[model samples]
Target: MNKDVRASVKVGGQGQWSDHEKWLIEQGQQRIKTLMPEVYKTICRYAEKDSNVWRIVRLGLVGRPDQFWACEAGHVAGAPFTQFKRAVEVSRLIARFGCAHVCMIAGHGDLGGT
Candidate 1:
């Protein structure tokens, strides 16, 4: 629930949200609503029924995952502590290189696909 552990970081050394950034937040919120309505509703509850109240900040020093969501306000007693991470698959690697290569690198198995 702590800020550092949550990977929350200031944008451009300023904790302010620009118009474009706000637009991106709105788009992300909408995507969550469409993909996972239940979770989106829960986040809205944490934001006090206003999705716009939720702040979208950048996370630092992480790879693979494109985004990470965490609620500091929900970390309090009797509240829900939830976290979500979004990641995208590499189509080029999956198609051309194949899972065998990825699996070996990921410690799943060797090139034989065992």
Candidate 2:
């Protein structure tokens, strides 16, 4: 996280964070199950495809996304439980499988959508 946010996290008494620090980190990630409520669909689709355990998602910017997926999901990382091969993959899953819990505010996509 940035220096300012780190500085803002109020430390609990006696060097104990009491979970606030960890919670701040999780919230910064911005991925939650509510945004991708495809549990039933995923279960039903699993039998037909058997790719649930082998869901291949190709996120860019370095590391092998498909390789460390289990650990990543355990921590609830990028795009939550899904991965994006391209731009449309983001919206497609969000549309069909998504249940939606977005907060746009008075702005556009984060960081100008890069």
Candidate 3:
């Protein structure tokens, strides 16, 4: 059986989205639609299937994920929920399996040959 793990972290603060943040989310969605139509369609389908509501969650940190896509289903037994997160560029490569290869493919320059 699968178990859900919930942990708490200090959020620092929360505020309304700024113009740039809103624009970034818009642009990100557009890019996803264009570049990965299948993924975008999957998100839409899940959103509709789980709940007819799509939510964009804002994180309180910059240089991190700009937006998170989730389907909102009110408290119910065996409710369906799904989340998608934006992928960012890898800035540093650590000594791990396939790190060097991934860094090369991502064009993050050589990381001292890993």
What TM-score would candidate 1 get against the native?
0.31
- Which one is best on lDDT? 1
Best by TM-score: 3
Query: lDDT per residue, candidate 2, 16-89, as tens digits?
Result: 22355445434432332333334323423432544322122112101223221211222333233223233365
Error of 3 at 52 (Å): 7.5
Model 1 residue 48 CA deviation (Å) reads 3.8
lDDT against the true structure, each candidate: 0.31, 0.29, 0.29
**TM-score of candidate 3 against the unseen true structure:** 0.36
Candidate 1 yields a Cα-based lDDT of 0.31
- Candidate 3 per-residue lDDT over residues 4-109, each given as its tens digit: 1012111343454565655544554554445545445555554554431133212211113222322212111111112222122232212232231110101112
TM-score per model over all chains: 0.31, 0.21, 0.36
Candidate 1: segments with Cα more than 4 A from true spot: 1-16, 49-53, 56-114
Error of 3 at 83 (Å): 13
**Residue 37's C-alpha lDDT in candidate 2?**
35
